[model samples]
Target: MNIFVAGMMMETNSFSAIPCTRDSFVNAMYYRPEHTGPDPEPAAYEQFGYRTFLRLARERGYGAYASLHAFAEPAAPCRQEDYESLRDEILDDLRAAMPVDMVFLMLHGAQMAQGYDDCEGDIIEKVREITGPDIFIGVELDLHGNVTTRMAEASNALVACLLYPHTDFDERGEQLFAIGERFARGEIRTRNHLQRVPMLGLYYTTLPHMMAVNDAVLAAERQDGIHSVSLMHGFAWADHPDVGAAVIVVAESGQGGVPDLARDIGRQFFAARDETRSLRRPVDDILGAIAASPEAGPFVIADVADNAGGGAGADSTFILTRLIERGIKDAALAMIWDPIAVDFAWQAGIGNRLNLRLGGKTGPFAGLPVDGEATVVALADAIEQEDPAGGLMFGIGRAALLRIGGILVAVNSIRQQVYDPVCLTGLGVDLSALRIVVVKSTQHFYERFSTLATGIFYCETPGSLTLDFDAGRYSRLRRPIWPIDADAAPA
Candidate 1:
């Protein structure tokens, strides 16, 4: 059996001021097969979901063709020309590798180009046009997306990351391949139903109520004849007609009650909105909680609004400013994406002190740069961090660790969220000694960070990706959804 595999992932936040370019993808990743001509070997894609497909092919001794793997940090819509060039490259590769038994694509279903609202759907539709209906088509998706009907209808199987921190990337990737193998062998016909819930919000799987949703999805998958279940907690910043929570249930063709199961999950999730709302605390609110709580050390505070993974300028100084004002000591903040600061630190040399301005330079929402004399702690020319979202190694280019007052701040040239402690630890910032650790991420940072934190706080703020569902950011979104209407009912 032969399988053609490729991927392009970038989440778009329509409200972000920064535009995503080709360099964004190149800087993050741009991979092609290592060999040329006859027997091409796939590159050593460390920690990518696509690597799972290649691994399966190698272990099973089946033919695999990997082409044009691209990934960029979350930002505004990608340039149309860049999107077309990449999309066409994948199509051309798939055409040249013709007559494959299966087509597997790793995609972030929320990606958007200048003119394309549904990049994932567009790519899948185009792939379907090339591969035809007989070929088993399976997609591995990041659950934070606008789960559109076009994508679900065109592909035979759609498997999304089951967790918000997305620790299940490789697991879901393998699951997709297993389903594809079953379909290709005529063992079972794959039938999927995407049931949309009229609610648009993000949820942390670590929270009790949200964990219940994850448990429910997992339990549903273990039921008879069920192939998979995914709860698509749509990206709130991306404005689209299909932007919201959705339940996708993949069941064996001719299986009964698929729609009912999907509807039941979606409805239950929506009905529990009030309970999940408790996790969505605003910036000052969480800060107040920290001051009042008697809990001793190592509180993991998520700088949610400024999360680069959700298209926020990781340069925001809102939370830092608050912490500084409160004179919070023994705290560490990571990955304020400021290349200038990193460059300045490199020039100043480690163990030296210099007056520097950090972050808040992107847009109005970023607030002002934290200005003060910071002592450089450590520096690295190029560093890589483990990303739990896709089990991938993320490059943090020309990074530096600086201490301002009693706080240790990590600044990196790469625009990304801090996924693992190594992003700081490698640079000599000790996590075990800190009283508070603030990471610029929505939820993907939770998996590993939770272990170190005595408590966790998710703070909503006025930063780029604010959690306010009624923030007037939507124009293209379908009317009457969740907080947008409050009484909007899903039919």
Candidate 2:
């Protein structure tokens, strides 16, 4: 069997001011077909999820051909020329390597280039144009993927990871390959159906699996003829027309229950929409909760609005400023994206004190950059942590740990969500020794930080990815979407 691998991942936030240029991917992550091998190091896997498919093909002795592997940090819609150049590279490769038995595409569903709103759908349609209808095309989508009719109509099958922090990356990779193998061997006829639900909001679907939508997906998958069920949470930060939760049910092609199952799940989501949202509180209110809590030591408060994962600048000082004002001590926060501060700290060297301004550089929402006398306690060229799911290493660039008035703040050069403890522990901050820990993330931090915190609180601060969905401004999105329109339902 011959298998082709290719991927393009970028979670876009239309509200963000950052432009995702070609340099974003080039500087962050970009690889040619020849650059990748069958087995990849953990750090590479964390950066790019494409290695799993390549490894699978190699292990099975199948003809595996890799295309461009590119990933950019979450930001505003990609540049038109930049996205087109990369898209053409992947398509051009597929065109050159014709007559392939199968194709596996790893896509982040919420990509929106300058001129293209449905980037994933556009790529899949182009691939279909090259491969025709005979070849088996399978896709692995992020749960946050904004599933579209174009994508659902073009691909043979689509599988999305069930976890939020994506612990099931390998499992989903194997599942997509399994679907392709079965199709190639004539084991079972499969059909993927997508049912878009008219709902838009931010929510946490972390472990302990409290979300009802997750439970419903599992229940639907257990039913006869259901091969897999995915609740594409839909990236709420992307202001596309199809930006809403979707139910994708895969089952036997001839099975009559697929559509019904899909519709039922969609309805379930609409009925339980309130439960799907995270409980958020104002910064001061959340801080009060932390002070009153009788729980034993360190508590974690998520600065959700400033989560870099959803394209908000991680440098927002809404939470950090308040912590400083409250005179909170023994509290640590990793990473405030302030390269200026980091550079100053680096110049001061370790154990040296310097007065500097940190974070609050973006806008009014970011608050004023805090000014204080800080001591550089720790410095790292880069910080990386192994993902417990498969040892995938997630990391960011140059960082410095600084202590200011008993508060430890991690200053980073790059922007990324704090998904793992290594971001702090690597910078020499003793997480256990602190009374409070603040992470600039919405939900991704749940998997790692929850394990260490005595209690977790979600802060409803102000920034680009703010959870006040109804208050968001959108110029292109069509109206009548849920929450925005009280009587809205899927069209």
Candidate 3:
């Protein structure tokens, strides 16, 4: 059987001011039809989902036609032309690579283009229009997706990662391919049912192993006739019509219990709504908590609001400035997305003391600029790190480590979250020596940072990806969704 693989990965934040351009997608991870093969071990930042699927196709002795694979860091709505150009490129390639038995896609369902609210669904339907009804379509999405009826209807199977930090890309890819293979071999025809629960909030506190939603999904999967189950926690930051929690169940055809199963799972999620509540605290509250604790071990602070993974600028100085003002010692705050600061540091040379204004350059959300004299402790160009999920290398362009008092700041030209420990160690800062470690990430830094720290705290600082979703005035989303309305009824 022939399998066609293509992907467009970007988690769009509707509130963000940054517009995702073609260059943004290209710079992050861009692959064409020419970039194909059985790459069992792709780069850390490479498109692992497509690569894994391609590897599985090779293992199954199937013809795999790989098309445009582009992924940008989470940002605002993609430009209409940029989105269309990339979408068309993939669609055109899929058309040229016709006669494929299956179509496998890697997409972040929360992605929004200028005029397209449901870009994933749009692409899926377009692919369906091209491939016709005969070809089996399977998709792998980030759990943060807003799974719509159209997305479920257009695809044979829609699978999302159970983990929020999304550590199971390869496993999910394999699962998606397996389901698609069942369709190709005429084994079991699958039908998908999506249940959108009226809930809008951050779910950062729940770990993968202990999440009730994941447990409910697992329970559903264990039921007879149920082939797959996924709970899209939903990107709360997005302001689209379908911007809320969702449950998707893929069951064997003729399975009448699928809808109930999907609803049951959604109900379970809604019942345990508190589990998904954000555990973000103000900076002062975090500091107080730290003072109350007796543990002298490293504390990993999650600067959630500034997380680049959630479309924040990743250059916010709110937490860093507070730490500095409070005279916090032996702490390292990383990956402040400041291109000018990095350039200035490079020009000043390493080991040289220079007066520099750092961070807060991305406008109001990033906080006021902090001006101070600091020593350039370390400098490195083309700094790259392995993404904890797949060990794929992502470049953090020209980096500099600036030391202000006892605080060490990791400044980079590239706008990226400090998802990995390498973002710090790559700059020659010994994380072991630090008393506190601040990462500009929401939850992606959990797996790595958790291992090194004695305590971890997620802070609700002022920035683009704020945990206080209710405060934002969203004109697109419908009324009565969870805490936003307080008395909202669950769907």
Candidate 4:
């Protein structure tokens, strides 16, 4: 069967000041063959979902045609022109390649365009109009996907990664394709049932270390006729009307079975909602733990509030500022995404001592740029490396190592989430000798660093996607949710 695969993904943070444009996508990650070369395909960390989907579909003996796949680091809502042009380009390609048996999409479910709040839903609806209702459509989404009713009604079948800090992209892609293959053979008539929890939150609830949501996911996986079960923690940054956590169950038939399974899972999710809300430690508590630890091994401190994966500007220097204040030496922060700083460092060359202002360039929430004298340690144009902690592959764009005061910072031109040590060691930064390693990511960093770290702490700070949702100046989110009201009854 002929299958068409294409994707456009970008998580929107409504609160962010950064406007996502075509140039932003290009600067962050532009993989056009004409621009790069014939052999070296445009590759970036954000395209992980799309690449895996195409790879799995080709392996399943289907004639897979990947038209185009484009993604950028999480940022503010996309511009109207940029969104329409990209959407039309993908749809235009799909129309030309019509008569395909199936279409698989990789989407960041929380995307908000200038004129469109439900862009993914709109794309799916438009694609449905082109392919018609009978044509099978499948989607692979991040666990942070906002599984809106509009999205649920438009797509034929959908699957989301179960793990937070998501290491299950490939696994979920395989599952989605398997379901598509089953549909092609007429083996299973798939139906999906989705239920949204009242509260809106981040990745704290989805952690395996946290029992409530984790056990519920495990239980749903055991249910019969349930091909796949996903718990979308939902993207908390997008201030759309459909912002909240959700449970989706894909069953064998498009009937009562899926709904029943979904309800079972939804109830459990609601029952445990309290336990899942806002799990984090204060900055002081995290620092105390680090000071108490005796192991010489590097400890990982997660700056969740400034996680780029959650649409926060990776340039936030709150954690870095505090590190410098504490006089913490022998530590590394793999990365602070600033093209200007990287360019300045590049011009300075390796071993050159220079004064530079790093990070805090995004906005006030990101704090002010730290001005200090730093020594250039190492420099590299491209680093093809795997996450030392999780084994996930990532491409680090033009990067440089600079030692500022007591801390070592790896500055990259590209904005990305640093999940593993390879992002550092790949560029000649030693991971074994450092006392602490600060990662500007949420839970995805856990998969790789949890075992290696003597201590892992999530630092509460200030940024667009801060874990302190209650403290955020939100204008749109539906209220009475947990933590927002301690006395309010659970969903």
Give candidate 3's error at residue 418 in angstroms.
1.2
lDDT of 3 by residue, 198-312 (tens): 8886664255423866776787788888889988889888887899988888899899877777777788778777653446788999888887888886888889889888898
User: Best candidate per lDDT, number?
Assistant: 1
| Residue pair clashes in candidate 4 | 165-443, 165-444, 389-448, 390-448
TM-scores for all candidates: the values are 0.94, 0.93, 0.95, 0.88
Candidates, ranked, TM-score: 3, 1, 2, 4
Q: Cα lDDT of model 4 overall?
A: 0.74
Q: Which is the leading candidate under TM-score?
A: 3
Predicted structure 1: lDDT: 0.85
lDDT by residue for model 4 (27-47), tens: 654443222111124352234
Worst 10 residues of 4 by lDDT: 33-42
Q: Per-residue alpha-carbon lDDT of model 1 for 162-191, expressed as tens digits?
A: 877787788898888999999999999987
Q: Is candidate 3 or candidate 4 better by lDDT?
A: 3
How much is the lDDT of residue 339 in candidate 3?
A: 91
Query: Could you tell me how far off, in angstroms, the CA of residue 25 lies in candidate 4 after the best superposition?
Result: 3.3
